[model samples]
Target chain A: SQKIEQNSEALNIQEGKTATLTCNYTNYSPAYLQWYRQDPGRGPVFLLLIRENEKEKRKERLKVTFDTTLKQSLFHITASQPADSATYLCALPTDGGSQGNLIFGKGTKLSVKP
Target chain B: DTAVSQTPKYLVTQMGNDKSIKCEQNLGHDTMYWYKQDSKKFLKIMFSYNNKELIINETVPNRFSPKSPDKAHLNLHINSLELGDSAVYFCASSQGQGAWEAFFGQGTRLTVV
Candidate 1:
């Protein structure tokens, strides 16, 4: 069976430090990968997406890198703040076809301390 | 205004009961979906509807039925709900079937007692 794995443990970091999260998958070749930020008691919000052909993608303070060869993606939050703390999820197309059918990872909870 | 909205942010019901959760999106997207997040915080896609037509239906149980009255609305009706059905249900929309970015609703937390 296809699977997406994220660090089940919560990541604790200083407010000003950079936070890096990893997402690894097996048995599926996705054309692109997406990252989402989910705050407690709220639904997830889209963050950034990186295509397999692209080495990296950036949006403001967020950056994402997709390495299809490794079947892994890295999400980095540079100059992170307390408000940036949340559960970060990595998703891929269910059948490597449509975004409407997304399969999400278990997600890694991030806590930034001030 | 909220882009994607679902009714009854919180629902507490008993087993063997029938219930329905309403969802609507004003973003005018071509695709909508239903996802269930269990207590373990695993979000799984249950159903997908595009242009008021069933597109993707996962290995969900027959007890869970999705109805799309129109392009803007998709409702979920679960009959004889089980305790395992308790989860946070989310409604989301995207511009097209291939669209990567999706806007999700606040989610409805259903608790079965």
Candidate 2:
């Protein structure tokens, strides 16, 4: 069986500090790995996606690194703020061939305290 | 101008009742999906429709069915809902099967009494 695991415990960080989240998977080689942010009671918003061929991708303040060798992806929030508090989910294509069929991991809850 | 949207942000109903949650996307995407988020926040895909055709169907129960009248809509209907069916259901749309980005609607939290 395929499994995607994110740290279940909440991550607490002081505002302005960098927050890093980890995502590990087993038995699936997804061509694309995507990240999303979900605030309380709201749908997840797509943040960034990195392909297996690419080592890293970046947005305004978000950075994602995909390591197929270790089967891990690290998400970093630089210059984090209180507004960055949310559950971050990592998803991949279900069958590796169907990109629309996504399988999501239990998100890592991030809390930035001011 | 919401890309994807679901109706009835909160739904409270009793077991054995039938209910439907409507979803629509104006993004002109070719694929749409339904995902369930459990109490522990584990998200899983239940169905996927592309161009109004069923493309992916997971091990979901027969009580739950997805109806895609057109390419822009995918509705989820639950019959004889059970207590275990209590979860947040999300509707999303993507450009195509091989696309990596998906836009999600604000989920509808369902409570089975």
Candidate 3:
């Protein structure tokens, strides 16, 4: 079975610092991986996505790196602000299934202090 | 305008009751999906539909059924809802079935009493 795991503990960091979150997977090779930001009492919003052949992808202050060898992906938020405090989820396409389905990680809660 | 929208943002009902969560997408996407976010904040895929056709059905219970009448709509109906069913349900849509970024709705918080 495929499994996705992120840092379950909340990460507290000061504003302007860089926050890095980890997402590790087991038992499958995904075609692509995506990251989402979810606020309290709301649905997740898409952040960035990286394909298996890509080493890194970036959008503004956000950066995502995929390591197929380790089956892990790291999400980075630079110059974090209080507005960046939210749960970040990592998702990937399930192997041997329809491309529409995404297997998500437990997510890591990030808190940015001002 | 909201790209993806769901009705009954919050639903609280008793066990064994039947309820439905309606979802509609105006993004013109061909694929829609239903996902459950548990109390622990773990998101799991429950069902997926493309152009009103069932595409992906995870290990979800039969009590939970998804109906897609058209490309823009997918509704979830739950029968004999249990306490374990209490969670937030999210509806999402993508441009196509291949790997693509998904837009999510506001979500329906279902609490089974």
Candidate 4:
């Protein structure tokens, strides 16, 4: 069975610092990976998606890197602020391709403290 | 306007009761999905519908049913709910059964007492 693991413990970082979260998977090689941001009592909002062929992707202060060989994806938020505190989730297609069904990681709760 | 919206942001019901959560998407997507987020905050896919047709059904209990009146709407109905069924349910949609980002609803926090 495919398994996704993330940092179960919450990440606490000072504001304006770089916060890096990880998503590692085993027994599967997905075509693409996605990152989402979820605030308290709210559904996840899509942040970025990086394909296996792409080494890294960046949007504003957010960056995502995918390493198929490592079966890992790293999500980074630079110049973070208190408002950036939220749970970040990593999602991959269940079938390893362009599929509607996605399996999400347990997510890493990031707290940017001032 | 909200691209994807679900009604009843919060739902509380007793065990053995029946409830339904309604979802609508204005994104004109053909693929819709229902996901369950437990206390551990793990979002798991339960069902997926494409063009009003059942596509992917995970190992979900028969007590849970998903109905898609059309591509724009997917409703989840749970019967004889158990305490274990208490979790946040999210409705999401994508452009199709392809490589597209999904837009999710506000999520319905269902609590079965």
Candidate 5:
């Protein structure tokens, strides 16, 4: 069976520091990987997406890197703030299936302290 | 305007009852999806519809049915809901079927009593 895993524990960091989250998958290769931010009692908002062919992607203060060889993706939030405190989800498409259908990991909750 | 939206942010119902949750997207996307987030915060895909056609249906129970009136709307109806069905239901939309960004709606929290 295919599985996606992230750090199950919460990540705490001080404001202005960089926060890094890891996503690892096994037994499948995805065409693209995506990152999303979700707040309490709300839906997830799209942040950035990086393709397997691309090494990294950036948007504003967020950056994502995909390593198909390692079967992992790393999400970085630079110059983080208290507002950046939320659960970050990493999703990937299944092997040759519905593009809209994504397998998501149990997101890692980040808490930024001021 | 909201890109993707769902009605009744909170729903409290009893087991064995039937209920429906509505979803709509104004982005004119071609594909729509339904996802469920359980208490453990594990998100899983349930169904996907493209242009009013069923494109993907995960190993979801038959009791849960998805009705897509058009490309912009997909609703989920649960028959004889059970206590295990309690979770946050999310609706999302994308432009095409291949590796595109998705816009998600504020999820509807369903609690079975």
Candidate 6:
């Protein structure tokens, strides 16, 4: 069975600092990994998606690094602001087809204090 | 306009009752999915539909049934809902079966009393 583990504890960081969250998986080799931001009572919003062949992907202040060897992915937010505070989820394709489902991590709740 | 939307943003129903939640995606995607987020915030995949066909069905209980009348719609019906079924249900869609990004709806917060 495949499993993904994230920091269950909330991460509290001051504004303007860089926040790094991790997602580690076991028993699966995901070809593609994605990141999503979910606010309270809202659905998960797509953030970034990176392939196993890509070392790192960045969008504005957000950066995602995929390490296939370790079966881990790191999500980074630079210049973090209070608006960036939300639960970040890491999702990966569970099966072969595009119609296949995604296995999501438990998610890491990030709190940016101003 | 909303890309993906679900009806009754919040649902409060009694145990043993039957209820249905509807979902529609205007993104013209070929694949749609139902996901359950538990109280602990662990999101689990319940079902997946591609072009009105079932593709992925997790180990969901028989009490739960998903119907896709069309490629853009996927509805979940729960029979004899149990107290343990209380959670948020999300509907998502992607461009194709192999698409990476999935657009999600606001979610339906179902509370079984």
> What is candidate 1's lDDT per residue for B1-113, written digit by digit as tens?
88999998999999999999999999999899999999999999999998888987999999999999999898999999899999999999888886468899999999999
Candidate closest to the true structure, highest DockQ: 4
Better of 1 and 2 by DockQ: 2
TM-score of each: 0.98, 0.97, 0.97, 0.97, 0.97, 0.97
* Tens digit per residue, CA lDDT, model 2, A1-114: 789999655899999999999999999998889999999999999999888899999999899999999999999999999999999999988888555688898999999999
Please write out the lDDT profile of model 6 over residues A1-114, one tens digit for every residue.
Answer: 888888555899999999999999898888789999999989999999998899999999999999999999999999999999999999988873245588899898999999
Q: Per-model C-alpha lDDT, please?
A: 0.91, 0.93, 0.92, 0.92, 0.92, 0.91
Error of 5 at B102 (Å): 0.9
Please, what are the lDDT tens digits per residue for candidate 4 over residues A1-114? 999999655999999999999999999989889999999988899999898899999999999999999999999999999999999999999999767589899889999999
What tens-digit string does per-residue lDDT give for candidate 3 at B16-36? 999999999999999999999
How many steric overlaps are in each model, in order?
A: 0, 0, 0, 0, 0, 3
- Candidate 5, residue B16: Cα displacement in angstroms equals 0.7
CAPRI category for model 3: medium
TM-score of chain A of 1: 0.96
- Evaluated on CA atoms against the true complex, candidate 1 attains a DockQ of 0.77
The 10 consecutive residues of candidate 1 chain B with the worst lDDT sum are B93-102
DockQ values of all predictions: 0.77, 0.79, 0.72, 0.83, 0.78, 0.75
lDDT of 5 by residue, A1-114 (tens): 789999655999999999999999999888888898999999988898888899999999899999999999999999999999999999988653346588899999999999
Instruction: Give each candidate's fraction of reference contacts reproduced.
Output: 0.76, 0.82, 0.73, 0.82, 0.84, 0.78
Please write out the lDDT profile of model 5 over residues B59-111, one tens digit for every residue: 99999999988888999999999999999999999998878888999999999
